[model samples]
Target: MMRTRPLKVALLGCGVVGSEVARIMTTHADDLAARIGAPVELAGVAVRRPDKVREGIDPSLVTTDATALVKRGDLDIVVEVIGGIEPARTLITTAFEHGASVVSANKALLAQDGAALHAAAEEHGKDLYYEAAVAGAIPLIRPLRESLAGDKVNRVLGIVNGTTNFILDKMDSTGAGYQEALDEATALGYAEADPTADVEGFDAAAKAAILAGIAFHTRVRLDDVHREGMTEVTAADFASAKEMGCTIKLLAICERAGDGASVTARVYPAMIPLSHPLASVRGAYNAVFVESDASGQLMFYGPGAGGAPTASAVLGDLVAVARNRINGTTGPGESAYAALPVSPMGEVVTRYHISLDVADKPGVLAQVATVFAEHGVSIDTVRQQGKDGEASLVVVTHRASDAALGGTVEALRKLDTVRGVASIMRVEGE
Candidate 1:
């Protein structure tokens, strides 16, 4: 009979998610051990400041040395929750070298250097599962990699960052500007003080890369994701969306393009129809809508991030990796089989809502119409306002390349009749 000993695990960070991982390890020890078919022990915990007070974990398990913990050679698995690009990446690689599997929630590291990490795991024949890295606690990664393994997903649109979603939700419901909604989110602990990652679309872009990689079986890096944040969106955009039966949500969209020969990923504030399921997703919650050729439409919705919620995802990966280890078999490795080129944003085809300020005159509409026509973009609908010198001309365009629309805007800006381009919003969920 094979000797069954406890699976010794080490945590590389003792922050919010790490703390919950430790807590759950102790609270649900028996159940986890039974499911894992062996003992699951918190062999060690690494922290930057070991003196920080942590509840539920015995002081003996804590250590200030993170590198030493991964070097413990005896460790069966290493769980890393530290979010960064440098030390976390190095440490995870070290763990794989030391013959231990790794589970991480570092989206930045994953999005930037995922191919390297996956190659490392394949070389060592060890499991590397990161379910919590994207759409925290939503069980998306494993399902995309394993359960939906056979399905050919065509599109994945997600509200993956909770802080931005909360702020945007407030803006959508109350017509609040970016700062006002951000202040409210910060007061409620939904946003941090600096808020660069969430408000600037950095966080969503990172998540988009990861989701795109798995959903489309392509290698998508952070640089390939086109990103536009919600800071520039105003009440006028929201009002216009409401008038058009739409709601604005920051979305990370991944689609196969080039006649289904390539993949593209982008993060931007978009107008989703009020009747769509993603439009109903409010507050700080997250949701991902996936469309496949045979699977049809599927939606995954849950808490995007929190200590306990993220911990749930971490534990799920731990169980899977541990099981694969015991079975002497590895999990699904990186699947970039399609190896499709990540297309740039300008090449993507989508509908647009362009609002422009023009002179309230008869020939103004005709001039604007000519500019769009010159760029090969057809207008779906046109709305004009104002009785005197000031007028607003809103043009909703049919599906066209972003490059074509951009050229039309540049031409209109230099025109003698058009005053300014008020705003341009992408329309989706139609």
Candidate 2:
């Protein structure tokens, strides 16, 4: 039996994603209602600019006051497309307090204050679903949170940010410098004007924090993630990557460390082998490689951003939350029961590809080797090329703690024979 009473949904924000959500809800209203076992209605839409005309939304639904809209006691679901902390957080909590479930695409807010938000939802006995937060429409959070609930996920490594991936992929394919690739991405509208959040790894770091928390069932905050921007990635880095039969990508990596006692999450530009699934992920696309004991290795790939793609994910969560509401229940809340401690970056063990500018002399290599040996970072390979009394010495190291690699670089910088540390990139997927 289907419910005759319509489920009232309030949309906060009428921007790109919000508009698409409304469009879909209107066009696919019958289908959504049939699937959800209840008629879904767009009861209200709140935006900052009420004067701006939205295609399908009613003028009566548009309002400047977001708080007032969410506070409306009749709303059954509040969908937040507003991507920020202040108003979004407060609005979500208010929605729960007033008896409404929430579906959000705010990664930054969730990554920072997910625990509090989850608590608020639990207190109000409402569902808080954010499937679109991490990788646009890639369907990641649900799998890690629900699908893989029975399995133990050991590792999650992938290119999660499409902007950074576009820049890095451009650099690899065209041998363009970072500026050139970033400029192209901007012109193509794949990058924002500021682009700091995406290029600087802040965006990916937030996603990493979310993934690490859910995958490991721990409370991983945004501050817990180790972030390194890809702005410094040069054509020379791509050249070195090609020489090693690899390609460069800005990766978000999360892992369980040392018998699952701790977990780690980081975002950085790293060299993944050419054959790896992530290296082949070209242009503004996303792919994640998940490793587990029973599942072995699984890859989730898709267009990570854009209004329609992101809206698809938001609608998926909408149907889910709607169905749960019809059933008089809630979905999975925060699974931080594991409470695994997030280890510092220094404790992360990984291989590294380090390029150094040094004097073209015999003992320079020996001095560098001594530093690595002293720091307990074993070198896997060393390649030296000389030109005009200057040499570019590239050293690939075996799996070693980040602490040892940092000490090695610090000591190498102090050496007179070493001109400078040109670049240091982590080697992954091998």
Name the candidate that leads on TM-score. 2
**Cα-based TM-score, every candidate:** 0.98, 0.99
Q: Give the 10-residue window scoring lowest on summed lDDT in candidate 1.
A: 1-10
Backbone steric clashes in candidate 2, count? 0
- Which residue runs of candidate 2 sit more than 4 Å off their true CA positions? none
How many angstroms is residue 51 displaced in model 1 relative to the true structure, after the best TM-score fit? 1.2
Q: What is the C-alpha lDDT profile of model 2 across 1-430, one tens digit per residue?
A: 7899999999998899999999999999999999999999999998988899899889998888888888889999999998989889999999999999999999999999999999999999999999899899998999999899999999999889999999988898888889999999999999999999999999999999999999999999999999999999999999999999999999999999977899999999999999998889999999999999889999999999999999999999999999999899999999999998999999999999999999998899999999999999999999999999999999999999999899899999999999999999999998
**Compared with the true structure, what per-residue lDDT tens digits does model 1 show for residues 314-368?**
9999998898888898889899988999988899999999999989877889989
Model 1's TM-score against the true structure:
0.98
Ten contiguous residues minimizing lDDT sum, candidate 2: 63-72
What C-alpha RMSD separates each model from the true structure? 1.3, 0.8
Best by lDDT: 2
